[model samples]
Target: MPDSSAERPRRIVARREGPMLVEGPVEIVLEDGTTVSSDRFCVALCTCRRSRIFPWCDTSHRRHSPAARPAADH
Candidate 1:
């Protein structure tokens, strides 16, 4: 029989310039007492304060470099 304690341990990854990745399913309780849950295998928690989906990673942390921006017409 498989050892119950051998199950994968939960992990959280922090990035200096991006969101915090967390092993899910996870539930977050806000200061307002609201609850949010994510059942994904991994969840990206927003750190840039720019996500449309607050507290979640919407990939808004990507750099808006000039090369990545659309060219303006002359």
Candidate 2:
């Protein structure tokens, strides 16, 4: 069994084929110099680059494919 207490809290969870989940203290900056900062404990960042939210994930990958989840490799 895995130890729950040993689990490390991730500041960000970037999916392989899907949106990236960011647990805040995260700062998102756009290419046009616009930025969105979040104090929330969790957020989804778009990996497919098709989200209307831009740097944020809006679960748009689900429309592209069913395997919509982040992976550990870049």
Q: Pick the candidate with the highest lDDT.
A: 1
Instruction: Give the alpha carbon lDDT tens digit for every residue of 1-74 in model 1.
Output: 23538778779998777799998888888779999998888999988778899889888768543455688999
Evaluate model 2: give its lDDT.
Answer: 0.72
Model 2: per-residue Cα lDDT over 7-65, one tens digit each:
67656665568877766666667789987887777878777888887777777778777
- The true-versus-predicted C-alpha distance at residue 49 of model 1, in Å, is 1.4
Clashes of 1: 0
Name the 10 consecutive residues with the lowest summed lDDT in model 1. Answer: 60-69
True-structure RMSD, every candidate: 5.4, 10.7
Clash tally, candidates in order: 0, 7
Query: What lDDT does candidate 1 reach at residue 4?
Result: 33
Quick one: best TM-score, which candidate?
1
